[model samples]
Target: MKIAIIGGGPGGYVAAIKAAQMGAEVVLIEKEYIGGTCLNTGCIPTKVLLHSTEIYHQLRNEAEDLGLEINDLKVNWRNLLTRKELVATQLVEGVKNILRTMNVEVVRGYAKFTSTKTIEVSLTAGGKRSISFDKAIVATGSKSIIIPVPGHDLEGVITSREAMSLEEIPESICIVGGGVIGVEFANIYSNLGTQITIIEMLPELVANMDQEIVNSLEEALLTKGVKVYKSAKVLRIDRSGKELQVTAQLGDDPFQVIAEKVIMATGRKPSGDGLGLEEIGVKVDRGAIQVDRLFKTDVDNIYAIGDCTGGVQLAHVASASGLMVAELIMGERMAMDFRTIPYCVYTNPELASVGLTERDAVMKGYKIKVGKFPMYGNGKSVITGNVRGMVKIIADENTGEVLGVHIAGNSATELIASGAVAMRLEATVQELITTIYAHPTVGEAIHEAAESVFGRAIHIP
Candidate 1:
């Protein structure tokens, strides 16, 4: 069985590797880099900047309290940018090496379907190459969205991609959209001493996450002197002498923010165009490819995954879909269980969630009991001097089934995996409480939270 995969991103590359391992002839095509947005511009680069800025922030703010005396500390923007590029390049090269070792033919080209079974590629080096396969997977990924506001094309206006590689840090920046991308960039720039003003159209930032945990993050940002304007809509951008002026509206009131640069972290949409999906009878709606639960498209031999499918727009989700599709093609019947997929935001006191949220559980008419353990009460959090969030567990009141877990604190991203595993195994609160967690660890807070579901918490009060 020969498989042709388009877009060589987390989704496409993973599918190619898995298919090749299963004894299929796999060819992976990528127009740009192998790792796509995650390794190139989106996840890896931003996290690199965030980590560097975070260390700087800690030294500047907590040096005295931690019994350390430092004088005249500053951030070297150029060095940080170089490190970010180095990390991304290493990861990209690593993926390429893996693909080669796996014997999956990696092609550098833009791919478009000629028929149901063949794809014609516009080679990056020159000319064209046609590939015939028994099956094809579309993992085209997504691109950042730039709102159609006036003066958006101005010199100072930029998107997340441009923000990553700026010549230097701006004196001030106004970030549009208060979602994950907006908030993460806000944290990164603000920590580097660049004045940040986040303009969110929603009532709060990261509106999709648990509101209680979001409140904690908002407080942290505010304490760092970052300005946040919620329920606000950007009308346009105009020049204000040497800087750019952002005009926005809050309810019926109009206001303006002056910044040296503006970042449009509005969101992202499917990049499914130019794939010849429409011509080949693959259904697409509003630029997103239509796929069923099995990641199968309208054409039986064609499959779609990742952001192009317009489902969860996380790299991990795309990779999971790719694995499932590859297994299915190799005579293994499988389905993706999305319920345990974790959502994470890499901000200070990182936020993560898995399964249903408290509001969603209530809305679904489930009688629930919620347990929360503040980070301040945890020994590890207190010892590290970064106790500013909590672990929340929502369980079925009658069955004690762990319905969801939400966390906002240090290692929250890493710790939330336990919650995801619990939900995946359908573990009850009793099971979590019975499971012993190491002391002097932030994860013990999860045990406390589980115990709290029944008002038996030992750590607090």
Candidate 2:
């Protein structure tokens, strides 16, 4: 069988590899570099900076605790970006190596369907070709949403991609969205000593996340001096000398902001625009491609995954979707279970959650009991001096089954997976509470939270 995967992102690349392993002749088409936006710009690159900012912040807080005196420490933006680029390059090369080792043919170019069974490729390095395949996967991912406000094309205004390769850090930045990407950038730049003010049209930042988690990170951002504006409409933007003049309406008065640079993290939509989805007999519901439970579009022998499908724009979600599609191609029947998928916020006090929230459980008609555990009560949290978070678990009140787990604090992002897996396996609160946790670790918070479900918390009063 001949398989063609378009857009070498997490989904496309993973699908290509899995197709190859399943003994199919695969051709992976990439528009620019391999790994698409995730490695080249989005998930991996931002995470690289997030790690650096985390370490930088840690060192600043550690000097007193570790009793090491230092002076005049400042972030070298050049060095920091250099490291991010290096990491991105390494991962890009790694993905290419995986493809080559698996004998998957990689065509570097933009892919669009000229017919139901043929795709045209326009190479970045100057070549045009066409490939005929028996099967194809569309995973073109997404691009930043650009608005038609005045001065939209100003040199200082940039998207998430341009924001990643910034040659120099700006003195002050005005981000146009207070969603996940916007807030993440706010934290990254603020920690790197860039003045950041996040403006959101919504009532709160990360309006999609659970309200409890949102409140937690909001407090953290305020403590770190990030200026947040909510429910404000941006009217226009113009370049004024060496800065950007942004005109926004906050209630009655027209609020003006002057910043050295502007970033539009206003969210992204399916970049399936111009791909000729309509011309090729593909159906698009709204801005995203329509897909069934198995990621199959209306057309047979054609599959769509990742950002193009638009259910969840997360990299891991795309990866999981890829695996599910691969399994379906192998004649396995399964649904993409997102109940155990974890979400993380990389701020100073990290926020992470898996499964339903207490409110979600209630909305779903589950009579639930909540377990709460504070980090201040844990020995490791106090010893490490990062005692500013909590773990809470919601469980079925009558059946004693764990419904969902929510966390806000350090390393909670990595810890919630345990709770998520238990939830998936239908593990009761008693099962997790009885499970052995290692001594002197933050993960023990799970046990404490579970214990508190029945008002038997040992660590906290």
Candidate 3:
């Protein structure tokens, strides 16, 4: 069996490897470097910078409390970005090595479907070629959304990609969106001593998360001196001498903020264009490809996954989708369930969640009970002096079946994995409470929160 995968991202690359492992001859095509945007430009690069900034901030601020005296430590932007680039490059090379080891044929080009089973590849090195495959997978991901506002094309205005590779960190930046990308960049810049002003048209930041977690994140941002403007619409951006002036309307009043740079972190849209998907009879909706439960497109032998499918834009989710599609192609039938997929934001007090939120559970008509334990009650959090959030568990009131878990605190991203496993196994609140959690660990909060469901958390009361 010959399989052709387009877009060499987490979805495409993983699909290729899995298909190869399943005894299929696989060809992976990529236009740019491997590891895709997640490793090259988005997730990995951003996290590298965030990690550096977090360490810088922690050492600078927490050193006194830890009885360590340090002086005049500042961020070296050039060196820091160089390290980020090195990390991304190394990971890309690692992916390439893995693909090579799996014996997946990697074609460097842009793929356009000529027919249901044939595609024309416009080679990046300057030649056109065609290939026919028994099956194909489209994993074309997404690109940053650029909002249309006056003067947006002016100098100093940039997207997340450009923001990551900035020659030097700007003294101040006004981020235009308050979603995950925007808030994360806000934290990154603020931690590095860059004045950050976030202008969000929504009523709150990261509106997709639980309201309580959002509140905690908002409070943390405020404490870090991030100026937040919610429910404000950007009217225009203007070049004012050396700085950029962002004009926004709050209520009936219009105001301006001057910053060295402007970052447009509005969101991302599926990048399914230029591939002739619709021309080949595959369904494309609002820039995203439509796929069935098995990751199969409207066409029988073609499958789509990741950001292109518009189901979930997360990298891990894309990898999971890839694996499921590979299995289906190998004659093992299965469907991908996204309900328990974890969502994480790598902030100082990280935010992570899996399964339904409390609001979602109630909306779905489930009678739910909520258990919340503040991080301050966790011994490890108290010992580390980084207790600024809580762990929340939502369960079916009558059945005690765990419905969801939301966490906002140190190592929250790692802590949410246990919650994900519980949800996947349909584990109940009682089961979680009965599970032993090692003392003085961040994970104990999960246990304490489960106990809190029964109003029996020992730490607080």
Q: Against the true structure, whose lDDT is highest?
A: 1
lDDT of 2 by residue, 102-202 (tens): 99999887788888799988887887899998878888888788877898789999988888888887889999999889988888888777888888999
Pairs of colliding residues, candidate 3: none
| Window of ten residues with lowest summed lDDT in model 3 | 331-340
Q: Give the clash count for each candidate.
A: 0, 0, 0
For 1-461, candidate 1 gives per-residue lDDT tens digits of 99999998899999999999999999999999899999999999999999999999999999998899998999989999999999999999999999999999989999999999999999999999999999999999999899999999999899999999999889899999999999999999999889999999999899999999988899999998899999999999999999999999999999999999999999999988789999989999988999988999999999999999989899999999999999999999766679999999999989999988999999999999999999999999988888999999999998999999999999999999999999988999999999999999999999999989989899899
**Backbone clashes in model 2, listed as residue pairs:** none
Model 3 TM-score, 2 decimals:
0.98
Query: For residues 163-185, could you state the per-residue lDDT of candidate 3 as single tens digits?
Result: 99888878999999999999899
lDDT of 1 at 376: 96
Report how far residue 420 has shifted in candidate 3, in Å: 0.4
Report lDDT (Cα) of residue 112, candidate 3.
96
Off by over 4 Å in 1: none
Greater lDDT among 2 and 3 belongs to: 3
Off by over 4 Å in 3: none
Evaluated against the true structure, the overall lDDT of model 2 is: 0.85
